[model samples]
Target: MANTHEMTVPVTRPTAARQPHPSGRRLTAHLASVADDLTALWQRLEDDPAVAFHQGRAWVEAWREATGANLCLVTLEQDGAAVAMLPLEIKRSCGLSIARFAGTAFSNENTGLLDSVRLADLAPVTADELALTLSQAGLGADVVLFDKLTPATAADAPYSALPKVFHQNPSFQLPLFADFSAVLAQINGKRRRKKMRVSERRLEAMGGYRHLIGEDDALALRLLETFFRQKALRFAAQGLPDVFADPAVRTFLRILATDRDANGRAALELHGLELAGGDHEGEIIAVSGLTLKHGHVTCQFGSINDVIAADVSAGELLFYRMIERAALAGHKLFDFGVGDQSYKRSWCPQRTELVDCYVPLNLKGRLAAPLIAGMIRLKRVIKTSPGLHRLATWLRGLPVRRQKAAAEPD
Candidate 1:
């Protein structure tokens, strides 16, 4: 049965309350059908450095609204205060109900639930108490799969401490120094400056350009539409799938850009480089979306106007502007998010380790776990091996390559 508001269960003891929890304190898992239940808890931890923006209440709610995914929140409360929680979107697949972290496919990293208090180190539990509780609590999930987890995840609890394999693609981030020059030194300062100078001269000749931040809601929405068009064209050129082709995704991104909290902190922020007064005056050259929380900022996605993108390097210039602003604002890290692009590698020096964890709650899950694990392993090998990765890319691009060859004058 699908999770419903009627299935909402209050905070209570775990159904499998046999032994004491390893933390010497109870961390009981409870089922909540509505994500609104987290509003109160989110208020307490919204600013907590431990709580990532991907797990932020607004971000989660936006995803749910946009995708219409069934929400099944598993909250662990201790002494009445919520210590940790997992907001999952239950999906039925292969005769089994699988509970996955909401927005997992789009998220850069998953920090499997962590105690908000950051309590002292606790011994690892042999059994997955959270999973056990979830199984019996009956949200109708046969398996709980958590993936794209960063190595920085807390691992004392059963849910997070289980055996796992490295995730497909590791995330990347760069330290943001207050002095912009100091930041440059960490990533080929000389070469970066030379490129920046060249881009500046080119842009200057083209009636100059201005970096525009989407502070205005209307302008931000417009920029977002432009980004979609740019990305669709780019993806078509590369023969890659257009992830943004889904209307739901577009709606989700729009919500992220518009929905804001009392503090004006929206789930997504947009920035672009626009032509000032050239023949294509006011036309956007590059667009980027970002998510910021506490002192960390992550690039969600970016697109460029490829037709006129030869020597201007609009994308790089936009990043330089944003990175400088982030650094000046004292943000600690500028994450490049998921993927292994040449630009990401050159910009971000720190590679964050990622992992996946799967817990089977029933016979069906147990039977299917191995198959799922094997597939994940294969994907990891392909992503991590340079030769395999190159071959895979070449294969994926074959259609476009073949088309171009056929169109050439013989």
Candidate 2:
């Protein structure tokens, strides 16, 4: 049996409740009391076409295993039918309870689930009501943070509508076409698109190259291992924290890579570029991790071989092939996910803006919210400025440098 914690917030008529909504049905908010109930609610929400893979049950389960956070799944129901749901994971930070959307650390999109039927009827609780319930739920959280939420999610999703500090985190996306050539034609720079083909030819001339899409678990695992190693080297060189260094996160990704949904489609798809001959024969030159669902393919993470064949732009070549694959699979969108990269802009013409919403549940939270918002803003400024970003990178590498020195022979 799965351990569960639940709380129910009653709602009378609109006149009685603190927040007012359109008169149609009285909705009551409650946390899932058991694993069975949570699973059932999750299934119902997953049925909605708006629910993304990150907000799905499989991803949530993987997050639970990876982080072991206290699950707090809230549901708003009308006449016993679930209308909305917000999945959260609670943890203590700096002696204060903090609740954030489940899988926020790794998930590119964090959209709360909402029943399409209820949404059509405009019967689901508003953002205000949801926030009020969470604040009074007695979950002992000092603050609730919802990150990377978009306005289109869940009928005016609370993250963007709530009275809180909003921080920008934009994502890039490309609309897929029926053919690869059509997609390439839409890219802004003609020279850039031509250059991509030149890069592919360059890679081909060096013996040969192949785009490998791993469907089998064994092959996927091998590719994933390579991805981790390459990612570690890249991060170390850039002086950035290696998030994949954690064993738990690695295990979670491995499980995700191998997992298939009821439709037999993998939760995570592994794609790589392999050199067929020469000094780098059989070497995985570049690898990209992706998630496909509801006609959308999201790039989770990707890395390339900077040491060998750097001039060929293996990563860019890999993306061209992957985008073609997604287009052939009838996907509607190819999302670069959250980031500001020069390559992303080359492929994705549309920029989807995202925001982080923070709500204080108590006195302590009130004090922490501004500090958190300021920090996020500062980081954004640093990331956008090349000089500051380089300085920040150097500062981050100091710890690793010290560790290396300590291990060196005297």
Candidate 3:
């Protein structure tokens, strides 16, 4: 069984005196002084349909434990009732104080918590007011960087009202059907079917294989560790920086994988492919980590023992099985997340556009904004062009050479 952390917070205003806005709607923003304060606001936000698992209390708590950053919760109030909340983290990045959405390293999608009824009637000016208030909330941040936001999320009054730079990062999603066959029928062309059949045959020759869904926290943690090791190998082979190499990131993932939600389901689900008999018999050859919420199953990361299961395409096979499992479990959508991979396109027909918002809080932030925007634009260009991307990968793969030290004069 996974560990459960029940969050409980008392609803109260900040200790500092709050002045009424000119429009008569009191806007009070403060750093959540304690975990309980955040828990209370998070519980209230849970009632709103717009809040995703990424912005939930559990996810934020995991992130806080992994990265010890200051938590700032900004709330907008009307008639002494909170209408919206923005959960942010303040940290120093690139020599400047910055505020960013919490859990950016692991969250696939993010949005602010908004009161549904109020959101429906929110005016453009009011949205702008909320954004302005957050910028000047005295969080000691020079700028705000909001990333991985979809249009539906950004449409929330506060985000929509902000004057900021935008960048496009597209994500993919597949609308699932009642059965696996129905889902397969839509994407399983002759070539794909042939490949899948070949993979199945190859795996069968290797003494059979089984797809295993972890049922306990211990098993889940073990599988997660295997995934991290496999991912590290993959990253090294491809000359890419291993984000999971950081111990903090691993700790955060473990917390997520071992935490249970209200329904007794682990917040992070782990699945693996195990060989029944072979040189690597009883070992998990491939693994996938995912999260299920709001009728959607989002694939977070996956890894395979390419050296041992390359012929069978274990990673893809595992995904096929997971998709079937998700459909059988009544998930309405399978999201591949934000990436432009040929494999993702083969499965997900729907594309969601994401945007990044950069808000300058002071004169220093204004001066640094363009540099940051330019870097993002350059990365987008490199990621989109096949030749450039390949070249970049090759360059990254080249080992760094150290120059010989000069000999001392005789």
Candidate 4:
């Protein structure tokens, strides 16, 4: 297959002089080839506190590690002062290239980190000039995946008209309450009270519900392993092969953790809820690994140990706590990241759509894009279809018992 990636050039307006004008004050895209510039810019920017990768000295270092194909950075400068910055990474595999955000698939959402205050004050001339400058920059990518964008920033983005640029639905955001009482009120007053009642009774009858946010260095790695094991087995049992079962996928996460850790000097957060009591002591029921990006917190990867704690509501409690911590930390958003789940809806009334928009750059690739999209849509339909899904599960040698066994350590 040829390198079949789509490229989007910001739509431009023809100048009165009959020239196409770039939308923003000629924004400049520069390769963060200089460590000093990147480090300085990252530190000065009001980045999301939850994400360590985009802050301080480490962000520059991460760029060095993942320097494969050059997608470079778009630096919007106003009179020599850096105003807006977008870090982009381009990856090539299987003879195809795609431009996603730097560390995106793993990142909950990445922002262009433009100065809304400055942008808001700009005249049409300034906006066009900036856009033209960025447009002229020698940035090349087959496809641009502008991951999860905050509503505020996305609203002001100059490149919104770029092909395939669309806002995903409002992502799920959980309101962090000041106290447990506030949290329970949001979950359906009566239902929340009942659940809490049940939880208290269970705890009194047993020992207590244990919540752990592993602070150990090895906790993140271990939790990630468990999550993958559970997720893979679950998918396999459902008659679907785990897409992330590939080593490269695993390697990417490991590398991501290591790289981000080295940069931020902080380990990933791994939250676990366990059933602790009686003969079955310390059985893990739910686990989640979340990534912090500046002031934005996102639930990255996680799994629930539903077997032993089916009655305990460990997962719900854990998530509830996560929101509390996020709110306490003053995080603006707590992204459930991607996916639609019943629990997510309970906590968040808002949701954003994640779309894979395509603009075929080449004739052959263009023709194939629609077909590929249809195929993807079809796969989703089949996977979600109840009866066929069960059949597929059976064919995949799926059994709950076997799944549990496979998940256990030797």
**How large is the C-alpha RMSD of every model relative to the true structure?**
8.2, 7.4, 8.2, 8.1
RMSD of 1: 8.2
- Per-residue lDDT tens digits of candidate 1, residues 133-203? 67766757877887776654524354444556666777778889889888888888888888888998998
Would you list the C-alpha lDDT of every candidate in the order shown? 0.77, 0.75, 0.73, 0.55
Model 1: residues >4 Å from true position, as ranges?
Answer: 1-26, 78-81, 118-123, 158-160, 263-265, 390-410
TM-score of every model versus the real structure: 0.87, 0.87, 0.86, 0.70
Best by lDDT: 1
Score candidate 2 by lDDT: 0.75
Question: What C-alpha lDDT does candidate 3 achieve relative to the native structure?
Answer: 0.73
Put down candidate 3 lDDT per residue, 1-410, tens digits, no spaces. 11112212221111232233456545555555456766766687865656767877777878888877587776766555677776788888789988877887677787767787875554443433443566666667777777777766665555655433334346778778777777776675455567778888888888889888777898899899999999988886665777898898899899989899676688889999989887878888999988877777889888999788777888888888888888888889998887778778777767776766666677788788778777777877888788988987777655411111223344
Task: Mark the regions of model 2 whose C-alpha exceeds 4 Å error after superposition.
Answer: 1-18, 21-25, 33-35, 120-129, 154-160, 164-168, 188-193
In candidate 1, residue 20 scores what lDDT? 56
Model 1 alpha-carbon miss at residue 258, Å: 0.6
> For residues 1-410, could you state the per-residue lDDT of candidate 2 as single tens digits?
11112211221122223455556565566775345667777887887767777888778877777767687887866656777787888888788788887878899887778776765554444444655666655555887787776645512533324443324456788889787677766774466567778987887788888888878888898889999999999987875678899998998898899888676667889999989988779999899999977888999999988988889988988888888888997889999998877788767767765666666777888788778778777877887788998898799888887776788899
For model 2, give the 10-residue run with minimal summed lDDT: 1-10
Candidate 1 local accuracy as lDDT?
Answer: 0.77
TM-score of 4: 0.70
